[model samples]
Target: MRVPLALLMIATPLAAAKRPTVAQLQIQVKKLTEERDSLKQRLAATDSLQQDLVAAQQARDQAKADADAARKEVEQLKANLKANASGGDTLLKDLEAARKEAEASREELAKVKAENAELRQQVAAAPREGDLVMLTRDVQPARPLNLNRATPHIKASGFFASRPTGVVVVNVLVSEKGEVLDARLLQGLPGDSPDAKAANEACVQSAKNLVFDPATSKDGNTRFKVWQGVGFYLD
Candidate 1:
């Protein structure tokens, strides 16, 4: 009932080959899993770097404010020293301490500046670094949208400058300080001409750099997620 020797020899190699395929497939699966884990780690690292960069910017700003305050204190101390000329020794000691405080603050400010520059470079060098801007439509400000204080420099080049009766609508996230955090092109021109595209880009830029009154409420608890339309009309 068994196979002959010649047939058995031939079938043996086929079975061996089949066995190796499963092992090879297992190896491939393991390799793929490792790659996936590596990618996940990289993505997590990128997010961490982005957060650090934001924190560094905030620290740098605070350092600058501290330096300014220290300078003002030194100036006031000097004035007090002059006014209290009779108590010269006491005022001189106070002035000296104020100068030292100012110097320390300046040094701290310089250190923060260098750290911020380094962090910025790191963030820029990241291959998969993404924008921190988040555009959301679920925003209701306490006050109504006021374009009276919103003045966008909507000067389009190439097509829009010479053309007339065209409008570009942009959705923007405005901060409590009246700064445009980010913008997206909600509506562009009808056609896809080079000029049209350029105009649309211009509209986005203007929206990003737009100057407007703070859309925040009296308690400053408002988000200015609003649509802004820039238009060109014939004279």
Candidate 2:
């Protein structure tokens, strides 16, 4: 009986030592749950960060496209401005050529009027049938006797002062005594302005002051008409 009781006591202590407590098991389970929750939260945060990165990249690409479109618009405007400038230059050249042509036409018209007046004077000066007795005598042609003396009067006139350079046509009738009987302006410069009229009148006055050599024809008749063109120039 004493030996059996000692073995029973040793068996009882060994069984109690090997058995685990409920508090220790509960603590281990709580620690494992916390570790799983932490891992899940980390994965969720990483997904959100990736989504934000994608959105930013898309915005950047759109901005680049907008910038390219704006640059193209600016280039087109510059090309249009250059084309307009070139067209304006062409228009200016056309205007200058037109002005030169108009000036040439005015000069030509003045020359024609003067030539017509000169021809009329020649026809009137020809001998008539009633003057046959005067035509029978030997005569000399009419010629200027004081052209150098008359030129100074024309230069000092109001007509020459207005148009310093141009042509004036005058018709003069001279008597047998070498005296000017009549003088008139045939044609003058291009315009009929006040200055041109004054010039014409001045030319007529100058012609009246002229003296000529006796114009004796086959008949010694010195009465004749003459057409003259005088040019004025500024030195």
What do the candidate models score in CA lDDT, each in turn? Answer: 0.51, 0.46
> Would you give me the overall lDDT of model 1?
0.51
lDDT of 1 by residue, 106-213 (tens): 787788789878877865652221222222222222122443333333333444345422445555555555566677775566788665776567657655655656
Return the TM-score for candidate 1, rounded to 2 decimals.
Answer: 0.34
Candidate 1 total steric clashes = 0
Off by over 4 Å in 1: 1-43, 126-235
Residue pairs that clash (backbone atoms under 3 angstroms), model 2: 137-218, 137-219, 138-218, 139-216, 139-217, 140-216
Per-residue CA lDDT of candidate 2, range 84-197, in tens?
776755545554444454444444445444544554464356654222112112434356666645542223334345433344556455566667778766446567676566
TM-score top scorer: 1
